[model samples]
Target: MFYPLRERISTWTTSQQTAEEETELIQRKRIQDLPLLRAAKENDIHLLKQLLEDKNCDPFQRGAVGETALHVAVQHENLEAAEILLDEAPQLINQPMTSDLYQGEHILTFAACVGDIEIVKILLDHGANLHAKDSWGNTILHILVLQPSKSLLCQMLDFLLSKDGGKTLIDIPNARGLTPLKMAASEGNVTMFQHLIQKKRKIQWTYGPAATMMYDISECDSMEDHKSVLELIATSSKSQAHKILNVPPVKELLQKKWQNVGRPYTWFLTAVYILYMICVSLCCAHRPLKPREDNVTNQRDITIYVQKTLKEAYLSGDDRLRLVGEIISVVGAFILLLSELSQAYIFGLKYFISHNFWRDPFNIIRICYSCMILVILGMRLTDADGEVVPMSAALVLGWCYIMYFARGFQMLGPFTIIIRKMAASDLLKFCWLMAVVVCGYSLALYVTFQTVDPQALGAFYSYTMTLISTYCLFSNLLNGPANYTIDNPAMYSPLYSSFCVIAFLLMFNLLIAMMGDTQSAMAKKKEELWKAEISGATVKMEQTFPKSHWFCSESSGNDFKETRYISLEEKKWHPFHLEEASGSSSDDESDEDVPPQNSQERNPNLDPYQEIREDITDRAEDRGNVDHNDNEIWEEELFEF
Candidate 1:
């Protein structure tokens, strides 16, 4: 047993020596890497070359935090040094570069994040894996699209897509499950979104049936956001929402959404609307009255009396506590006004004017609400009647307050469409028809009876009397117009008898039929109508507010910025077609839409950059702007662009 233990002890000693020696070598290599790491960070190409030439030097070696020399080259934006390193040892292309700032980030991801096109191109040319992700499973394309930088975004997309021969490379999702297209939509960046659309068309990529993938549902922080996202997806160019999800009426549903409301900047407008409404309601609630014991009081006493009157009105009015209700109502109205004004500005002067701006039902209601407040204040100035609440104004305010629940109904989805159809469409039409028919009957009946009975309708053909008489003719208002027969036999004209029969038989029945048909038609196709409304709303929202900054802007870094902006002049997204981009003929029937897997590889002559040069060269020659050398410079700069 002692002899066996001696053997085990000898083996243990040997293993310990090996372990010690390995630790020493690790420490030595790390010490040696210090110079190489320094050279890489400083972009000293000569030092980098010298370091690599040493037989013991390992370019593949990780620094203390797993960053390779290539990662250093990318991290510092050292294109020249990166080139030399990549050239001398091309295998350094796909290093697992990690650092404190960019922990576990691959070299490709680092290059893309910097918006360094040339470095990205060089890395791609050297077979760097575009598919490789960082710790977050986000590819370089995912990082590039985090913000709206058309130049970097388009080029990076063009390069990867061209290399991959299609959209499959760029379609990779991030840790949050957002694909590049959905990310673009989420930001509401039109230019970048259009680029992605063009790429989709270039690849002829028909999106699959996964509507959830097309739009990130969880990105919607509110009901408004969800509605907007649904709309954006529905109306998008590659939107398979029509064929795949095939929801109907996408546009109408979105008209009420808060697409541009999430930004903190717009919250001020909402606050204003709320405040203005509150002030209006307070002013209308109660007015200051004269002191009861007015025996030639001093100015201070008058002031005190005025203050007390206002204070009581502001606190509680008529024992119903209407002061609190009035204050809240006016605040909401103020909020409504501010919101409307902001909407007008966002909609633009031309759009607002052309749309007959005030025709909106909300605008009409606002006008009536404002008018009632004004009239009440105006009447207050006269001693004849202090604080005569304009019944019309009070009535409108009552409706506006009650309609608060209606605003909350937007969250009900398809049912919201039904409500809108009933309130905005059917109700308006019914009111218009009623106004024409009722006014005609009111005029005829009032003219016939007013001369004979002066107080025939009890108010001598005043608006109130005429309205009451009109209602009486439709049905007996407590045996209404029939009471006139007891006073005088002449009250029954054949014309009056015919008018009552026609009004009840034809007008009421017609109104009922029209309203029924409208409601039934919508109910029959409620699902399709709701979807269509949502889709239209999604598309139209972008049309209305192109500058709306969506939520994805939160994660955007220096990596996703405009290194080279595609000018409005260059217009061409692809060398061939600013025309197609303009929705013109170039987009019409492209043979290249169905290109094969190796189309770009097979056609070296079809380089879009080269095509752009030829077009610019021809244009420059035509304008006599500069000789061939300047043209060459311009062409070179264009390629850089």
Candidate 2:
């Protein structure tokens, strides 16, 4: 097989880096022979205890693998050996690996990754650091996501969260800047993503007026996983995405950011779009007059076609208004076209297509309007006069697309969303049904009556004419089907009546019912749905023009400060800080900076961790959930261990 030059160079570079790292790890590690570590690796419980009994033996010493005996025991799943090693040297429980493969990873992380709850519990009980991170800054929860068994992973997460200070571990970012929740989202693990998000019960008031949540929007600034969470959920299921967006913390965060950053940009775009619309209207209204075909032209002939060039229109003082309008319209259309292309560039072509950008009614209208303006200018330049249809279309689309801009306003935003929802869903489905019915009925009626009464059908006895007649007859069904009376009592007459009954009475009623249901369902979540729209809008702005580009980048109210003050009631969430909240005499100025504790402080009643654990437990209740008997055996052995 052949490889590209770039691929070869990349592979060589990665290999070289790996080799250098391994060489460095080997140099730093003490690769001396150690019988205690060896005994643990071989699960020799008797030898491990005998070696630990020796006064000179260092049970805490790392062997060639740069891991203490506890790490080796955990790695090899030597439960008895691990317990003996821990008993010999409790400090070995938190000893980090210096080897290249597991560099910076502690013994407890190794035990967690080993998928043995007993070993994990034993290590944690021995005072292993819960906040330990590997070389990639991955916490125990982060490493657990890599395990194949989601059920076991969820179970482990629940167990860990039940421990002290585990909530803090949920949002801790890795070296690549991905939290466990974000990593799950990036990997397209819907269940894990949902579980991670719903389990986050942390909420605190920042030093400033702003509030903070476990899921920080600021952390999503990295280009690699900027939109990974939202994009994954949206692509997987729109309803799920909406639900996530509507979550109280997520919605509040988005709302605050929009007020600080997104509102200004959105207002600017609204102004520009408004200008484009005005320009379009002016160009359509003040068209350049055509030349007089006859010596004495009537009033109607003067506005027939815009046949004059810009220079000619300018020279003819009477038509100079049209020239100015065209110039402005052309500029506006070019600007709008660039904006449209920018969306494609920002989202990338694959995402833009997969998300069905073109299917959006607003995008379709805006695109058609912009393209039509350019087309009209091209036609004018090429002397293709009397082009009424394109100009009329541009006018209609330009004004109608105001609904897209209307999304920025609170009052009109939900109404526009409801309209868009119906148009995209019910209207589209209705149109497809109408096309099928019209085409099918038109063909059936055309074939049925053509051979029997060719002349009665008329001289234009074609499918196109038949389709038109059938469409017109659909309207006449309200008037009691008067055309059926004129027709002879025949088979075709009954067929026409049946077509009217099915297409008009049945399909039309179904469309009405669908629209009503959609409206009613959406009405319940109107405010939430509106917030979701605003959140989506802000997210787009955030991705396109990041905070780094903001001129007023002052970090006060705009910035979400890391230091947040938790109330006494909510102090259980920060189990480590309960003593601090207890008014201990500490000289920390940051703690003094916290506002006076509020008596009305409230704690979250819902325990998402417990709920998710129950859900996972119920799903994995039966052995039949596993595909293979081997899986059951593996799970059972691991759990029992």
CA lDDT, every model vs. true structure: 0.55, 0.67
Error of 2 at 578 (Å): 30
Stretch of 10 with least lDDT, candidate 1: 204-213
TM-score, cand. 1: 0.39
Cα-based RMSD of the predictions, in order? 28.6, 16.9
lDDT of 2 at 220: 32
C-alpha displacement of 49 in model 2, angstroms? 17
As for candidate 2, its clashing pairs are none
TM-score of each candidate structure, all chains considered together: 0.39, 0.56
Q: Report the C-alpha displacement of residue 132, candidate 1, in angstroms.
A: 35
TM-score for candidate 2, residues paired by index: 0.56
User: What alpha-carbon RMSD in Å does predicted model 1 have with respect to the real structure?
Assistant: 28.6
Error of 1 at 22 (Å): 93
Candidate 1 lDDT over residue span 1-641, tens digit each: 77899999999999889977875576456646588777877888788889889998877877755778788778789998888888888888876766553555778877877778888888988988878777877777766766446676666666666666543675677675666655665554445555564342211011121111111122221232333345445434442333322311112123323333222223443455455555544544444444555465564354323213433334334524554555465555465566567767876767764452433354556656655654554453343343444745655564554333233223444555565556677677766776776677677666656666554445325656776667666655534344434363364466566766767777678767766877787677665544444444334434444433543223111111222111111222325667545643545657676435544467887775665445544544554212455446544644564
Of the candidates shown, which would achieve the greatest lDDT relative to the real structure? 2
Q: Where is model 1 more than 4 Å wrong at Cα?
A: 1-331, 353-360, 374-416, 455-464, 471-479, 484-493, 524-641
Tens digit per residue, CA lDDT, model 2, 278-356: 8768767767665555554665344534355545656766466667767788887787778778878977978776564
